[model samples]
Target: MNDIRLYLFQSGSQLCKVHDIKMNQGCGQDMEIPVPWFLLMHPKGNVVIDGGLAAEGLADPRGYWGDAIDAYRPRMRPEQGCVAQLATLGLSPRDIRYVALSHLHCDHSGAVGRFPDAVHLVQRREYEYAFAPDWFAAGAYARKDFDRAGLRWQFLDGEAGQPFDLYGDGALQAVFTPGHTLGHQSFLVTLRNSGTMILAGDAVYTLDHWNETALPGLLASAVDAVRSVQKLRALAERSGATLVPGHDPEAWRRFRLAPGYYD
Candidate 1:
């Protein structure tokens, strides 16, 4: 039996012009991709990867999302909230011991407050960039979604290019794939029968993007972004891991969405 179980949940969908995600491709066309949040069941504790959209945002996008609401246009359902989805597995936020954030982007960290007791794990630089006075210089970090009070935050400071093993065992680790954002990171999870799976969190938006080394519409550093993809490709080749992309509707169809799981 596998020591860790992984569940991929569709928290919601974010619709944006295709060019917004991948530069120059489908310039005037719109595409909607599922917003995914993962639940990892570990022997030591349960972990939530990316909190998805806030529950309130589901009912009132304009109120919570503001101007970006018109840009990203997230389509959320009440049942997709972290709390409701966890219930399907006979769990709750309190059951989560750690909430791992790939980055503090609104789509990724909106529901972080739901797991008040879980220790929130984020790259130190990513956390700092989220709160920096000029954090919005690149324009995606939303203060309303993050910057919540009382949640236990644990900063992980790992050397660039080095993967941080969250558990002593090699079952789970954080791969530093900076780009897309200053401190964007991906995760590598090792399962028993399933082998290895790489969760490429916005570092590589889609398989097409990965294949062509395409840049996103909004990017901090194109050079760094391409480097991140190259690193991920090499890692995937090295480990023979299945790379779970961040926001690719077509790519997402290949997976079994929760309440199904990969163990």
Candidate 2:
């Protein structure tokens, strides 16, 4: 029997321009996309993959995100925050043993601090970049979301340390997939009956980005982005794993939500 259960949760939704998600495609078109976070319930310990948007945004988007709100407007509900979503399962931040972050973007790392007892696993380069990002990505990283002194962190260097198996088991893996950012990563969860799942963080934004029809918006490196997308695609195809894209509204609808889990 599979000892792992995966649950999906939406922290909120963001209304953004097509070009904002996919590089230079839909200019004036508006798209409302779901911001999702995940939890993996394993016999060993629980892990949170990305924490979704910060709960503070629900109170005041402009005040929390500053000028960045103009580009990707947030529409968050009270029950959609990370804490609230976990509450439905009778779980809390303290219950999580580890937080495997894909990157340090404000949306992805917002609730990370709440898991004070959990070790925050991130790429070393990403850690450095988030604090001192270039002018182009200056608005994306909100330091306040993850800059707590007491929160614990576990850093992975490069490929050598990565595809890091959480709990020293083959069940959960942190796959280094840099491109969307300097230290971006993706995750792989293996279940006995439900098969394997590839959680493509921002590494592959949507099917358009996955299928190579369009590149993702705001690329740190176009070459790296393409390589990472193709790499993820190949991995999924080779292993017959379900590849879940980041910020895909259509994909989100198809997903089995919380209360319902994949074991």
Candidate 3:
């Protein structure tokens, strides 16, 4: 049995009005981006990637954005959160055994509060950056949300290109592909029957960017970011894995969406 199934939970349909320079260059017709949350199921347990923005933060937009750029607004409501989406599949927060974070951006770590029991799998460097940030340069990540009591965690540390096996059997693996953040990582999942899928977090936000080899403006270092993208592209090609971007909507349209699941 190919007990693994991938689900797109939150479908954030918004036009990317900003450009690669982080300046308000007006809404270019070619700039719409899709922000998505993914859930992966295995016979052993369920694993969620990137928790999405919290409902509370969404309710008070000022709280989430502060003085950040508002050139683009999410078309989806934060209150219609990822947890609620998981509920639609008859799964609760407790069902998730592991929560794999691509990086600690507020949008990706917002729902961490919901899964108190799941062991958080993140890169050690990423966690450290989130805790003490250079707000003047790299901005901030929501580290306070992770201070919950008894929260279990697994940190990956080693050479940059090495891969971490989530299970000894090669069913799930985490590849360190830093650039978007110092310890940012991407996951490679092999289904019992569904083949391979690579969840390439913000390593490549859009396929267009990936295809063009263009780095996003928000990256800490453009040089490192491009190197990461090259690593991802090589991996996907060599392994024949379906690469899923962190915020690309076209990927949603190309996959089979479960009922009540966002496409």
Return whichever of 1 and 2 wins on TM-score: 2
Ranking by TM-score: 2, 1, 3
TM-score of each: 0.94, 0.96, 0.86
lDDT of 1 by residue, 1-263 (tens): 36689999887898889988888888589899888889889988888999788777766777776777777988888888888989988997689898899998888985587876788888988888888735444346677766777878888875455688888777778887777777788898888878899999889888876897468776667888898888888988999999899998998999998877889
- Pairs that collide, model 3: none
Q: Name every residue pair that clashes in candidate 1.
A: none
Residue clash pairs of candidate 2: none
Q: Give the TM-score of candidate 3.
A: 0.86
| Cα lDDT over the full model 3 | 0.70
User: Lowest summed-lDDT stretch of 10 residues in model 1?
Assistant: 133-142
Model 3 lDDT per residue over 80-196, tens place? 577887887788889998888888876677567688578888899888777776764333464456656777889888355578887566777888887778888888887655678
- Which runs of model 2 end up more than 4 angstroms from their true locations? none
Clashes of 2: 0
In model 3, the Cα lDDT at residue 188 comes to: 84
In model 1, what lDDT does residue 77 have? Answer: 81
